[model samples]
Each structure stands twice: as C-alpha cells, then as structure tokens.
Target chain A: MRKDDTPNQDRRHALECMLWGGSGLLWTVAGGVPRSSLLGTPEAHAQSAQGGFSFVHISDTHLGFNMAPNPDPTVTLQESLERAKSFRPAMMLHTGDVTHLSRPGEFDRAAQIINATGIETHYAPGEHDVVEDDGKDFFQRFPQGARTGGFYSFDQAGVHFICLNNVTNLQAGKMGMIGAQQLHFLEQDLSARSASTPIVVFAHIPLWVVHEPWGWGTEDSAQLLRLLARFGSVTVLNGHIHQTMQKVEGHVAFHTGMSTAFPQPAPGSRPSAGPIRDLPPGELRKLLGVNRVTRVQNQAALAVVSSPLEG
Target chain B: MQSRRFLLASAPALLAAIPMAQAQQPATVTIDDHDYAPRELRVAPGTKVVWNNKDDTPHNVVSTDNPRAFRSRILDTDEVFEFTFASPGTYSYYCSLHPHMQGRIVVG
Candidate 1:
C-alpha cells in the first residue's frame, strides 16, 4: 500500500522502517542515516557497533490481570521479558502499569520476574500503578523514582533519558495530567542541556493527544513540548493505550509502546478504551510485546522497533 | 420581617413533613463496559446515591464541580461508593480513573 493513505498504512511503513533488527539482522548508521542489513553481509561485519547503545521499552504488564483477553497475563509478561532480554539492551524502560491493580502481591510477582532479567529498568507510573494508597506500594518497590515523585532524568552513554509521571491527580472529564510542579522540573531540567543533546523522554501516557475521549493523552504536554522544542533530537516514548503509535513533528518523534498484558482497540475504533475483551485463542500474544530503541553515536534520531512476544 | 417570621414558622412543619426514611430513597449508578449506565439521574434532595463498579477495570467517582461535592476511592469490580445529596442542586461527576465515564444527578 502507498504510504500516508491511512494511519494504519503510515504505521505499517514506519514499522517497516523500524524493522526487527534483533532477528540476527544488522542495523548500522551510515552518514548519520540508519540502515538495516542481513547479519552475514559484508557491510554488517565492516561497520563499527561501538559508541551506540540500545534499550528495551516495555509497558502495561498488568501482572494481576485475569480476564477474557488473556487469563494468564503473567505468562505473557514473562515471554515479553524474554523477548526484551534477547535484545541484551543496556537498560529497560518500563513505561508503567506494572501491575493490574497495584496490589502488593502483584507488585511482588512483577518485580521478581522483571528483576530476573538483570537489566537496569527505569519506570514511570501509570494510573493503575498509583491507585493503591496513592502509589505508596509502587514507590516503595521502585524507590529510585520516589525521590523525585516518579519523575527524574539521567544520562547514559551520552544519551539523556527523562522519565516523567503524567497519571497522578487526574481530574474528571480530563486526560492524563503532568501538573505544574512536574512541568517546572522539566523546564529546569532542559535548561541545563544544550540543544544538540539527544533527549529520550519516557512516560506512562502519550505526551501527545492520541485520543482525548479515551484519556490517552497528557493535558500539560504542550508546555512540555515547548521545553523540548529547543533540543535537536527528542524522542517521546509512552504506553497507556496498549498499542504502538508513532507521530513525527519537527525534531521530535513520538511513539507509544505495546502492552505485554492485553491490547486495547485503536483510537476511535471502539466506543471506549479498555482491554479488548475477546480475541480468538492464540491471537492475543501477537499484539503483546516490547519495543526496542537504538541510538547510534552521532545520529540525531533514535530507531524504535516493536517486537511481539511470539514469532 | 414578615418573610423571616413565615420561614421560621414553616421550618418545623417542613422538617416534620418529610419522613426521614422516605427522604432517602437510594439511587444507583452502575459502572460497566467503561460507561456509566443511566448517565443522568433525577432524585429528591435527600436521596442517597450509590455507584457500583461492575467491570473488571478499576474506576472512581469524583464531582466535576470545583471544591468537589464528593469523591470515592478507586473501586475494583463489585465494589461500591455511596453519597447522600442533602441539598437541591445538579451534581455532575465522572470516574476520575476513566474521566470519560461521566454521570449527572439532578436533586430537587
């Protein structure tokens, strides 16, 4: 199909561009442009793989969820983690909804499985993650984020990563909110960096409005975007809709990751947003998995590939 | 002065007119399929309203008015939250978790 005819086709073309390089394929940056090749090819052996790093982005594990879509979410989560582990990423960014109900047992089981992967994981809280005791349980388990109220930033291998919280203090008839306090922090955070920095921002809800009626977007993201406009390369990654969506504007690229738990209907396809209740048996896992992001040393844009749990 | 005296004289009768139990006919708002059923409800001033979550997904009730009239903790499936509207006014609320699921109550 010709590109840009429809959103699905656009997504298909984008997915083709961000093809699954983890299947023994080689991805290299030539003259700052990213290109993929077969593993046994001469160019694959000739390119330098150093100075570039990759990370796995997984979201909405929903460990305690047991429903029609998938009676056993934990098994799929495990399988997704296995797929992420295959990438052998420098780190893993769990965009949130780590547990279905944010229960203690759910948190415990999720941690045990994710920790087994042994990759450093950065997290932001989804609304589901903050429901119990206003997120006391989630913060206690993921203490690294607690200090800054689940929003923090760090640098890894020359790439700056910012984790943000947009799910707290949600209001009626409104979408996700990144309150003024957090927005202020983001402004100060960006002011210190030069425009050339390749910034990777991860959050639970999509920073851009995917669908306002379903509460899939963040309310104050315009301000966040203004702060990021100066940056030469900005990648905003999120997962709340339980599907992959991509949009590019100026220097920033926006992408949402797929859930490891269940799939939600595409925006406007269904009346409301929730887990898609019925999928013919064995069809569930095809829509469930993780996304991998890679940044070559000097390339301004990061390459993101969505990997399904099953082949 | 005459209006004040009339209101004072009628206050006791008005208090006695409404049987306490009858004033509190309970109303219900069911959360299912990610939508609030009976999105608009009408009831007496003192009616007690209960919101029950029937979907597996978690939900909450919060008044849309600034200085919210009432709010509920996140409710899991089969869980319920109740509030009594004692004054005459229109109250609008939505699930704070799923903000699009909105409902309204006209109490008079």
Candidate 2:
C-alpha cells in the first residue's frame, strides 16, 4: 500500500472493528476528529446564579519519570495543578497512573505535591500503577476498599461517579479488563438509581475501543457500556494514551484525558505505541492539555472545554 | 559540666552502636541489561529489595505468588521499584513484558 494510504486504511479498519464490536455505529469524523453526535446540542450557559458543579480531570502525572519526554514532569504537574486551582474546581478526578512506578517515595512525593493543592482528589489505578505488586502500594496510599486497589464509587452534585479498575489483569497487546467481579459490583451499584440520573464513569484505560493493536483501548468494555446505556446521560472519562480523544454514542460520551507527564505518538505515528518526544517545549503543552466538565442541572447540558496549559 | 563529661565518656559506646545499625542495611539488587546485576541477593529479613530500571525500554519485575506477588509497572530509565522482604524465603520474579529478564531474592 502507498505510504499516504496507511493512515486511511488504519482508520477504516478501526471503524470496521468498532462496528463488529457492537458498541454503536462509528461517529463520522470531519477532519480526522470524531464528531460528537451523541453530545446534545450545545445549550446557552446556564445562569451563573444557578451554580454549576465543575471538576478538574488530570491524568498520568508520572511523577518519578524524568527523561527526554519532557524532563521534570513535576513542573508540568505544578503548572496543571495551578491551572486547576485557578478554576477552583469543586474536586479533582485523577484518572490514574499517578506515579511512574509504585515506589513509596514516588507515591509520597506525589501525595505531598497533590495535597499541597488542597483539592479533594479521587483516584483510580492505571495499568502502570497496578502492574507491580498487584496494586498493594497503590491501595496502601489511596485505599478505597478491602480489594487492596483503587476502585470505588461515590456521589457528588446529584451525579453518581463509578471508578472502575481495568488495568488489573492486563495482557500484552490486549486492552484493559474490568474483570467479572467488578462487573457484578457495577450491576448492583446502579441497580437503585433512576434511569434519568447522570452517571460519570472514570477509568485508566479508554472504556471504548480506540486501537487494540497498540493496547490503546479496553477489552470487554462493551459489557460495561451495556450496563451504562440504561442511564439517560452518562459521561465516561479515561486517561492512558497520554493524549486526548473523544467518542460519543447514544447517551454516552467517552472522553480520554491527556497526560500531565508527556504525550504519546498518535495512533499511527510511530511503528508502535511509545512516548512521542522531540516536540518544542511550547508545543508539548498544547499536545498535553486538560478537559473541564461542568454540569448545571437535569435539563441543562454539560459543557466540556479543553484548554492547553501553554500560555 | 559533669553531664558533658559523662557524654564524652560514653561516645565510644555510641560509636559502637552506629556500626550495628550500618550492618543492618538492606542489600540492593540492581536489574540491568535484562538481568539482575547480582543474579541472587542475600540480605537480612525485612531488607528492602530495590529494582532500578537502567534499561532504555520499559521492563517489569513480577513476583510468582499471591501476597508476595509484585510487579513493577513499565519503568523508563532511572526509575526505581523497591519492595521490602519481610519474611525469610526465596522470592522469584521475571519481567512480564520481557520474560528473559529474571532474578531471585533470598531474604533471611
């Protein structure tokens, strides 16, 4: 095949896989960007007096990571934290992989840095964090349950937030799995909620299939989505690929948050999935940005704005 | 002045206690070139085993059992993973991504 046609072919194949996978029809992309048909028409900003709840979504801090892929991740994290604080988010949702390794020192340093922000932080475990010791160190620091890993659910601002663990049983080249136990819990967790209630699902890996070949997506996510489909408005947030990508299926919006540490090569940029280094310092910030989610009420629409940290 | 004289007289005993503490330091086993530098490490019980990623690519050091099982996530160069061995036994580990990378830790 011609070199130019490679990306096109890959995109075509990805769409085909999504169709066969049976989640929903692939949303059309205008200019290599997936259109959010599922996202309801953008409504006017609700009256400021109505008071909307907004939260900061940051991922892949990779605190201990120090390399050419943007050396000194701490600076980027500090910048992101400062930006997050400026918005005065009600809370912060860290999608996971907080540290480069599950080292106590790394966790301690990360905890110290994040605690300095004074924002209530919710966490989930990334594949990187649980790979070592099956998440013992992670749970030790950010324990959520008797499971000894970071997986739990909470409610805030009239929305149910379910943090699922997909990185536990990872296999090479395979997407993340939430496992049968968690699946059962999810079924029971939402059993009492009314269908109209807004639901927010957070995970480390993309719950929707992005690219299974490079492990960019999750395996067996359809089962989880099937459970979520019952809700009228569901927003799924994830961070693993270190880049921002979004997909929307009926009543479900799947958004991947960018990493605060470094950016990864686009789906077909390199021969395989790895850190995409060599960007000018200014450009790196643009590639790695933050997404803010705000909700007003049942009738009002949720506004998601992506802002780059670069000045 | 008399208390100061007593402290000076006990300085040798205090110095003697310092070596005992130094002798209890954990023995570190470095993972380099797809192999543990020492191959087998022996240390006192409760000694912490640190696996430093000196390789360019990502590598994992995974244990073989349940409670004792541990795996270092993908580590870039200069990243370090430390686990303290609380029990006296032989702990075996291998790189889940790169099976060729393997080593053993013997804690007494």
Candidate 3:
C-alpha cells in the first residue's frame, strides 16, 4: 500500500511488507502463505491461557536515533515492546541491530527497555552492533561461549534455534558473510539434530538474497540454507531492511521483521539504503513495529504476525 | 649571462614543480545528511583527499578496487579519513554502511 493512504480508504495490499495498516497488523501464515488480520478483532485479540509456544521478534530498535524519521526511537520501541509483552510471548528473539551505532549508552538503554518485559532474549548482531572497537564492546556486552564467535544453538519448545553472527565480518557493499569457520560450527551443531524437528534461524541480515546491490541479501547464505533444507519445518528470520518482507521457497520460509526505529526504502528504490527521514508528522510510528511468531499444536508452519506501533 | 643561463635551464624544473605544489593542497569530501557533498572529485597526482563524516550515523570510506586502495574503520560524526594518491587513476569509493552513498575521485 502507498504510504500516502489516509483512513478514508485503506486498500488491501499483498505480501511485500509495505505500510499496510494504521493500526497493529496481525499476520498468520498457513501453508507457508501470509494472511494478516486486524489485531483489533475480538478473536485475534484473545489472550490464551495455554499459550503453547510464541516469541517476540523485534529488530533495528536503533535506540540513539533522533532524526527526521523518528525523533525518539526509544519511545516507539517501548510501545512496540509493551505490545509484545501483552501477548506474553515465551521469549524474545532480537534479530540484530540493537543500537544505532553500537554505543554503550544506546545498548544500555536498549537492554533496560527489553529486559523490563521479563522475557529471555536471544540476539544476533547487526553490522550496526559491531562498529565500535571492531565489535569488542558488543561481544563483551553479550558474550556467548568462547568458541562460538557469538554463534550458538539451543532447543526450545520442541524446536531447534540457531543464532549466527554474519555481521561481524562484512564484505564490501555490506553483504553479510557467514565465514568458513562459522559454517563449520553450524554444520557440527546441526548434524546431530533429527530432520523431524522444526528449525528457526535468526540473524541480522536476510539469509536469502533480496537485492544484491543494496546488500539486502547475504552473499553466502545459500550454503546455510542448503544445510537447513533437510529439516521438515525451517523458518528464517532477519531484520535489516526495517520492513516486513516474507518469502517461501520450497520448504524454507524466510521473513524479515520490522524495525522499531524507522522505515527504510524498498530494495533498489533509492540511491542508498538508510532510514526514511522525511516522514510526515505522526506517520513514523505507522511504519515502525514488532513481529511475533507462534507455533500451534502439531502445526508444521509457524504463524507470523506484525504489529505497527501507530494505533 | 650566468643568471640568464640558469633561468633557461630551470624552465623544465619549474614546469615539473607546478603539479607537485598543487598536490600539496588536499581536497575535501564532507559527509553530511547521509551524502558525500561533491560526490565526485578531480585532482592531480600526489593530491590528498580527506573524507569527514558529519552525519549523526557512523560511516566509513572504502575504495572499490582489487586489493582495495583504502579502507577505514567506522567514522563517527566529524571523524576524518585521508589518503594521498601518487598515481594518476580514477579511484571509486563509497561508505561501507551506505554503499549507495558513492563517490569517485579522479587523480589525473
């Protein structure tokens, strides 16, 4: 949908993660296809006591951002996080870019806000998270096992989750790289898992190539995807474009989550990729949001949803 | 007669010295508002080019060349990266964070 649409006529727009709604958007993917419903609906808003399995996915919070697109990113981040909390997600999966420039203050503020929800959060690094001291500061703040290089896997909710660090070593043009060392680690980590288990891989950059010129896609993610192909249910999540872009290829489903900070131009839409800085007053929040994915009982595909902060 | 002869002999040296003098005076590329003002620049050989990041977001200058000509760590706002060119060649560079924010420098 065009960003200029007013409430008088909100048209229906399909699949490409555009500014589709003024209020929160709740997307449900069945058969590997996305279908969104208004969260305002009574049934969609219902809180389940036996919330089987769900997690909040928020990306690009960019806490220090105070610019044309968003004067105060923390404000909207708070609202989006609060919205996720209301769902009572089991854990939070932060795809990456926790801060704007990897500043300590920004990370501190982001950590405080995210932790307030009382949910366990897992993180992958965005290139923004590693700009300072060659990512030493970022690694120090969120250290994993010494051998992992910030890459690790764990089991949760009968699903296997892998978090890879592709942003640490960026190639020219900002393409994400999962180096040989990390790939070997991934191979070993997944070699033992049974094909029957559901697999969710979260990272800062999209594992599938979206647009090569803009570095919207990872250069070597195809190899990683090949390793995951045997799994019966594979879900790949990412955050970098700051918009909701979803795709289903064969058995793998790829989804890029929304940013809580600001919106970015679509791939190849501009000369460069950065925050969309000239939003009209009050329009910024409409494009900023959080993504939620829930696994239903015996369901092979997870239900993915997005809730913009505007409403 | 000796001074006049010296002046005539020094002509070629004087001509050769001109470009060297110009090279001493460096050019500037200011990064502000997510753009490199004067996205392209032209200069003589041995001239130095300095890129200063003036935008709030951090950016870096990286030359797009085989065995890349230059690369800089993230430059916070107001930080600078300078490189001097000794050979005549067109050097293309861009911000690693914002690749589309490209710029070129021609050392002729």
Candidate 4:
C-alpha cells in the first residue's frame, strides 16, 4: 500500500459533549456547524416543530454476546426494536458488530430480531463480526457487492450515507484501518458530491482516535477525514466503543452509538475494552440505548437523541 | 492380599501427585466461563497441549501468528483441541469467538 503524508493539523476538533440521562434532545446548526441540547428545553420545542427527517442508529447488537452484564443480548435487542418501532424511523443504520462471534446462527438470529422492527437495515462489519472466516458469513447476509467487502454508500432524505469497512485485518497493537482501495472508493464517492450536500458516514470503529491504546481509533482515518473536510454538514457515526461519544471539527460532527448488547467502560476507565459484566442491578439497561438523529431543513445539525432501552 | 494392601496404601499419595504429574505431562489450559485459566503456559518441545472448552459457550482455538500452526473447530462445552509443539517458540492464541480471552504457550 502507498502512503500519504499526514496532514499538518492539530486535534482541535476534539468532541464537545454533555451526556444526560433522559429522553428528548434537539440538534441545530449554529453558524453552519452542529450544536445539540435537550428537547424538553426551550430551543428544542421551538425548532423540533420544524422536523425534516428521522432515522435510527442501532449499533453493536452482538447477537451472540451471551456473556453477563447482558447474558442474552437478543432479549435487549428485541426490547430496543420493540420500542423503536413506535418511533417508526424510515430505516436503521447498524454500525457493525451485528454479532459477538459472527456465527451463522448469530447472524440469522440477529436478522430475525431486527427484521421484526420492519425497518430496512444497513451495516458496517465490526471487528468481532470479521474475526473469523474473514467475514464470509457476515457478507453473505449483507452483500454490498462482489468486491466492495462491506464498503458502500446510498442517499436518503437528501443525505449521502457512506458505510465503509474498516474492521477487517486489524494489525496487532494497532487500530482500525481503511486501506488504499477503500480510500480511492471514498474519494470517488465524494468527488461527485457538492460540498453543501449533507453527509453521514458510518463505520464500525471510530474514525477519530477515541483511545488508541485500546484500538478504539482507526489507523488510516485521517486521510478519509481529509477527503471529507470540505463537506459542510457531515455527521460521522460508529459503534465499537459501545457508548455514546460526540466530537466536532468545524462543519463535521462525530458520534459513536451505544450498543444493544452490553456497555463497556468509558474510554480509559477499564483495564481493557470488553463486556462490562458487573453493574448495579437495573443500571445495565440504563446504559444500553439506540440513537435517533433528526434532521431539519435549514439546520446543518442533526438532533442525536438517545432513547435508552429502559422505560 | 499383600499387593491389595500396598495398592490401597499408595492411592492417597498417588491422588495427591496427580496434578504434579499432569502439570509435567503437557500444557493443560482450561476455557471456563470465558477465560483462559493460567492465561499462559510454558513447556518443552514436542509437548502435547490441550485446550478444553469448560464453558457452555462454544470456543475455537486459533493462533494469531501468521501461517498458524493450529486452528480448531468450534469446541462445545467439554470438547477439547490438542496440538504438539515440535519447535521452540512463543505461540499466542485465543477463542476466535471471544477474542478477549487470550493465552500464550512458550515452548523451549
């Protein structure tokens, strides 16, 4: 693979965030960038009345994630979808990790569970999904193309959504990677897009470095971000971290969706990134949720409201 | 009658020595409830290593090394996979299903 010079840039686009425990959030664009706040608050009802489009971000379902914290994740996934069906988003974007072990039956079970919601689903394979057989079974269920290997794009509600495959072939002691082929495809994909067009990019691992020591960041994401720099209203979504994290760089905003399976510790809060098995009794469900992003007409920002699986 | 008495007398001592004998026989790694017991093992060349899936969840033993020496079928509970090391080296492996559960065997 050829190399590109690392961009001379600072990590000034670090996420600005305030996580709250409740429903109803409002996302608006201030000065052509993204800003988010609670919905019960004033700014929410005012603009929330000006609804544009809505979709669901369901990630890390981990169908075979039978370990504790959540022994049978399929149950929570069912409960989450049952709740989401009420909102009735046009589609659901599953940010990879559809299964814990990428087993055939796991994929089948996840399909049955998610299909019950009656929502069309798009996916990016997580590291767990591609750990064995190099994603043979995963791609079988979600075939983008013969050579696409799970990286592709589509348009919906005036937003260009790109699902890139970055979880396969992770090098030892390294982070997620987007190889040269996918980079070329990305450049070609975006070359046709006007900078003003809103873009939503979804992948399994975080495109930005959340915590490099734990392989939470993508190794070759800088180039991809550089290609996306010109887009005015871009929202990047991911799932590996298993918690909600947000970031912004001028016109770009990054968000990692919470998993339906189990919650890992906050970045750097645990010895290693894996299932969090112990929690104060009902608190486990509180940490699990699905993200709802609502886009309004003139606002480049999209509302990212998290509806936890709990009532 | 004399042989019977001797065998009976040695039973307790032999039972106590069983673990030491097994420990010296080869490297025995247990996959119980999503963890690799001992997490690491050391042994000599030509050592026969065994990984028993003691957990209900299925697990497969696959080496992370390039040109992997051994890869096992998904072993259900109580199933086992065994391999003999002919050369001296460090071999790192994990349950392909649950990658977080890792173990390393050092052969000398």
Candidate 5:
C-alpha cells in the first residue's frame, strides 16, 4: 500500500506522508490471512468478549529521553499505561526499550509508571535497555526471564506466551539476533506444547526483516519461525521500529507496535533511523501509542486494535 | 622573599605548559543524526580522539575489529567520550546502539 506513496526529501512532509498512512489500521488474522479496517467504524470498534481474554502490548517507553518530538517521555508512557488499564487486559507485554539510555534512574521511573497500572507486564530487552552491565540491570529489575538471559515463556488463557530477547550480542552492521542459546530454548519450550495451542511471541525487534539498512529485523528469525511452523495459530508482536507495521504469512502474523516515547521515520523514509523531531505541535501523540490484542475463546483469530494517546 | 623568587621562576614553566597542553588537544568526531562526522579520521599515533554526541538520541562507540581496541559508555547529547590512539593501526569502530553508524580512525 505504501508503494503508491512517493518519497519526499522534506523530512516533515515525508513524516506526514508515512506517519499518517498507517495510524488507524485495525488488524485481524483469520484463517492465517491478515485483514485491516479503518479505525472507529462499528466493525473496528465493536468487539465480542464473551468467554475470551485480552492483553495489552506497549513498547519503547524510553523513560529518560528528554528531547524534541517529546520532552518528557515519562508523561506519555504513564498515559499509555492508563489507557492500557482501561482495556482490563489479563496482562501487558512490553516489547523492549523501557529506558532511553539504560540508566538506573530511568529504569526506576519506568517501573513506577508500569507498576502503577497494576497489570502484570512482561518485558524483552531492546538494544537500548541492555547498554548497562550487559543487561544485568534490566534483568535484575524485571526478573521474569532473568535466569534464561531475558527470554522465557508461560501459559495464559490457553495461549502460549514466549518472550524472546534478541537485542543482546548484536553483531555490527546486522539486525537483532536471538542467538543459538535462545533458539535452543525456544525449540525445547515449544516441543512440549500441543500444536493446537495458539502461540503469541513478543520481542523487541521484528521477527521478520522490516528493513535491512536500519537493523529493524531479527537475524535468526527464520530459524525461529521454522520452529513455530507446526503451530496452528501464531502471532508475533514486536516494538523496535517505533511504528505500526503488520504482515501475514501462512499461519503466522507479525505486528510491530508504536512507541510511547516518540515516532521514528518509516522504513527508508529518512537518512538514518532515529527520533523524528520537528513534528508540528500536538502531532506527536498520534504517532505514539499502544496495542490492545483480544483473543476469542476457542478461536484461532486475534483482533489487534491500536489506540493513539490522542486522536 | 624566597616565595616571590620561586613564583618568578615557575612563571616560565607555566608559560611553557600552555602550548604543550594545546598540542595535546584531541581531534573530535561529532555524532549527529546518527552518523559520525569525519567517518574516516586520520591522526598521528599517541593522539587522542573524542566523540561528541550532538543528536538527541544516545549512542556509544565500540571497536569492531578483531581484538576490540576501544569502547565507550553510552553518550547522550552533548556528552563526550575520548580514546587515545597510542598505537599505529587502522581502527574500525561503530555505534553499538546503531550499528549502521560506522567510522574508522587511521593512526600512523
């Protein structure tokens, strides 16, 4: 769909062209094919919750970041969590990049806000979060996957949830890597699960290659996907790109969420991948938000609704 | 009287220190928009190189060559990290956070 959009050298106009393009897409995967609708229509807003469960996914809070596009990321993150709470999700998944610079105080600030939501939140580390002590700080603060180097899994509502860490030990000039250790863990973990069970895998970087130049994809994600091939329904959620992108292949669906901190240029829309500063006043929040995923009981379908902090 | 004579004698040494300090001033590489300015820098052995992050995002410098010569802590905007290239060799480095932002230092 974006192929029709022309690339503009003007950064602001380019951002406008790309940022507004994907904002209101309501994504759903039924029968292993993805579909979308404009948000706010009855078909999009309406949801059936009878005998079903839902969860929230938010990413890239970047708590300590203080700059244009957003001077106080903490405020936006708090707002996102409050919005997430309203969904009454059984749990929340943070795809990674909880802090901007991986400082202790930044983690403290992020914790205070996320915990305030009172929802169990699972985390995967982004490259930014593991900059300190090789992710010892991140693991110590969020110990759900600490023993296994920040990747773990659990069963919730008959859906198997696997949180994988792909940011550590990243090779130069390459995308995020899950490495051999985590792949072995994933293989072992999935082997015992029934193939009929729905699987939701969440991580910091997109399991599929979004763009090679910016390192938006995961290096060993193909191997990871192969392990998941036997599953009847698989939905992959990620957060590193800081924008909304979704695709479906076979029985697998991939979606990347927006950041609560700031917006980044769409793939190949800018010279380099970083925060998109100089956005018009009040436009930042529209491009920054969270994802709310709903799973129907005994159904292979998952409805993913994205809500902006504003608009 | 002895203190005054000592001060006068030390004045020449202090005067000589200024130029020596100036000679030791490090070469700079500005990190802006996720790219290092002067992506390839040439410096004499024993010269110091400093990386100044001017972009809003945080970045770090890590040697990518075999044996990994130098690494720096994450540098936020306006923060600086320095490494003295005391050996003559081709040093390749990149921002660990954004690996695409690569650079090289040729010391001879």
Candidate 6:
C-alpha cells in the first residue's frame, strides 16, 4: 500500500517507530550523556511535564494574493481557521508572509480573518511583508523590542519559544540573516533552562542550510544551531518555501510548513524562482492545509499530523 | 523588420520634428524585484506612459504629488497600464501595495 494510504494513527505510529529506531539509539549517547552530566537528576524532566503545551503552526497566508493556482487565499485561510477552531489549540503561530504585499488593507484583511478564529495569533514577518518601509506596517501590527521588527520569544508550557527575524533589509540572491543581536538574545533566553528543557524556534526562513540558490536557507543559522545543540529536544519551524519538509539532526528536528495562499515549486524543479503552478480546482484545497503539533509528555514523543482543509 | 525600416525612413523627419513630436513617444517603465527596474526616466509633456507589472503580486502606480492625480488600477502578473502626462514636471510613483517601491519620471 502507498505510504499515505495508511490510517492517521498507523502513520503516526510508523513515524514514531522510525524516529525511535534511527535517532533513539543516538539520543542515549548524545542526549543521555548531557542530561546525566549537567542536570545530575531527574528533576529537570519532571518540571517539563508541568510545562507541556500544544499549538498550531500556519504560514504564508498571502491574504491579498489573487491569482491562479489558488485564486482566493482568504477563503482557504478561513477554512484552515475553521479546522483550527475544531482542534482548539492553545494558540496559533503564523510563521510569516501573512500578506502578499505589505499593504495596510492586506494586513487588515489577514488580521480580521485570523482574529475571527478567536484564537490568539502570533506572527513573524516574511520578505514580502517588509518590502516597503522596512516593515513599519508589520511592526505596527506585531511589535518587537529595540530590534525594530517582529522577533520575540515567549515561554508556554515547558518549551522555550523563540521567534527570530532573518529577512531584515535583504537584497535579491542573498541568503537570510539572523544578525548578532538576535543570537545574543537567544543565548540569554536559554541560559536559565536546564539542558533537558525543550526549545521551539520559529522563523519565516529555514534555519538549516537548505537550497541556498533560491535563498531558501539562512546564512548565519549554523551559529544558532550550534547553540541549540545542547538542548535535548529542539523543534525549528519555518514557512518561507511554501511546502512541507522535515529534517532531523542530533536532537533538533527542522520542519517547514505549507502556505495557505499557494504552493511554490520544489527546489530545482523550475528554471528560476517563482510561484508554483496552481493545481486543478479540485486538488487545490488538498495542497493548501494546516499542521498540528502535539506534545504528550516529557518522555513521551511529540506527534505532527497534517490534514487537508477540505476534509 | 518592417518596424526597423519604418524607423530608418522616418529618421530625418523624426530628428527635425524632435521638439514637436516628443509628446508622441512616452516612457515605458518596468517593475521587478520590489523596485522600479529603471529608477529614473525623462519624457516629454503630453506623452503617454506605460508601467508593466512583472512581479508575482499585484501592484499599483500611484503619484505621490497628487493622491488623485493619477492612479493605475491594481495590475496583476502579465498585466500593463498606461497614462498620459499632460503636465510638465517630475512625477513620482510607487506600488500602493508596497509603498517602498518608488520611481520618478521627469516630464519636460
């Protein structure tokens, strides 16, 4: 049978088994050593159970985008929101590129639709949102500190969530940057937590060195990854490429979410960078959907299940 | 080929009528990479101008000098719009969808 034909629970079980079989062995050497040497106790793991939380991650709504492949993004976004309401996640995190152009109207429309869900929505800016005026409109909507853009972190449950801005003041053909200031903040944020605490990093661009030819990866992300390597469970979520891809290295699992607006050509699929061809009307809804991440317990595994908006 | 011959044949008349016929050939501008392809241009009064939207999203060419002076409806991918310059002065335009996209046209 095809991999996707399996039931959702079976698929989840298979993924869990795979992760455990492949990475579980390495975790004992890499993850277990640090937990024992640094914490020297089971107290850190006990504290994390009290801090468990699950949330929704959505990206690249592109509210004002009205073109082929997916003509009305707002409609699909509403459908996603409706699905999200059913899940009733604690909160929703929008990875970035909320609007196609940083126009006030576009931002307003996106805000209205997101707020209509009645779930608090947090955002990071994408390259398109900051094209005009260095993200003035974006900051006005979602402000950060002296950083002058949206790059902030908050703690929920037991995980330390850090949102980094990597697309500030970018030019064409250049990879995204997180700058030194954000790095300093990251260091300070993780200093208090024991090495065993989970860390969730969200940004608009990929933190890993994915395909750089299309500026899909961040330039200074390796430095950030080195700092995060100490954590026992690190999850990095991004949304610039407009597709679903996952990678695991040591303790960190990097994943990119699909866009509600449109699909982009996979890396190296097209002649040059541009929008991915829109699927047929019937298939469009299947391509654009939402993702859910559930954290069960301190020792229990986390599960990510993606479902289409139409269903 | 036919247009090239027509231009060669009309070269002398075009040169002699440069001042009077200047209004006939307006400037054509291209928008790409979130900025004007040509940041600046020179044109003649009463000339008709065109702005082509080559980017992925929709864009609007709006004049900063006069909010209502001239505005092009939102131009989507592969769409184009033209406007006539009746006054003699430099006019600045930007993507209303993206205010940071700015350009200037000098109409003499």
State which candidate has the highest DockQ. 5
Flag clash pairs in model 1.
none
Q: Candidate 2 on A101-150: residue-level lDDT in tens?
A: 67778888888899899999889888667666667777888877436355
lDDT of 2 by residue, B1-108 (tens): 222333244466664554323323556666554456787787656556778877544667777666636766566677788776656778887665434355788866
For residue A261, give model 3's deviation from the true position in Å.
1.0
Error of 3 at A112 (Å): 2.8
Error of 3 at A217 (Å): 0.3
Which pairs, if any, clash in model 4?
A15-A247
lDDT of 4 by residue, A144-185 (tens): 632678799999877789999887766545678899999999
Better candidate by TM-score, 1 or 3 = 1
Q: Going through the candidates in order, what is the number of backbone clashes in each?
A: 0, 3, 0, 1, 0, 3
In model 2, where do residues sit more than 4 Å from their true spots?
A1-51, A145-148, B1-57, B61-75, B78-108
Docking class of 5: medium
Interface RMSD for model 1 amounts to 1.7
Give the alpha-carbon lDDT of every model. Answer: 0.77, 0.68, 0.74, 0.73, 0.80, 0.68
Ordered list by DockQ, greatest first: 5, 1, 3, 4, 6, 2
Native-to-model Cα distance after best TM-score fit, residue A58 in candidate 3, in Å: 1.0
For candidate 5, lDDT tens digit of each residue in A100-122?
99999998888988888789999
TM-score of chain B of each: 0.79, 0.72, 0.80, 0.75, 0.78, 0.76
Model 6 docking category: incorrect
lDDT of 3 by residue, B24-56 (tens): 567999998667888889887767789988776
* TM-score of chain A, cand. 1: 0.85
Q: How high is each candidate's TM-score? A: 0.83, 0.68, 0.81, 0.79, 0.88, 0.68
Q: What are the per-residue Cα lDDT tens digits for candidate 1 across A194-282?
A: 77677889999899999998888988888888898876667788999998887766557788888998999999897778789878878
For candidate 6, the per-residue lDDT at B98 reads 44
lDDT by residue (A1-311, candidate 6, tens digit) is: 11232223422111221011110011111221111111212432332233435578899998878877877999999987877776567888898899887788988888888987889877888877776667877777766532646678887766678898887744334578899888998888888877767778999988987777667888888889888977767878898888777676766777788788888778878754456664665767766766665554524333334545643
DockQ of predictions, in order shown: 0.48, 0.08, 0.19, 0.13, 0.53, 0.10
- Which parts of model 3 have CA positions greater than 4 angstroms off? A1-23, A40-50, B1-19, B32-46, B54-57, B63-71, B76-79, B84-94, B99-108
Model 3 interface DockQ? 0.19
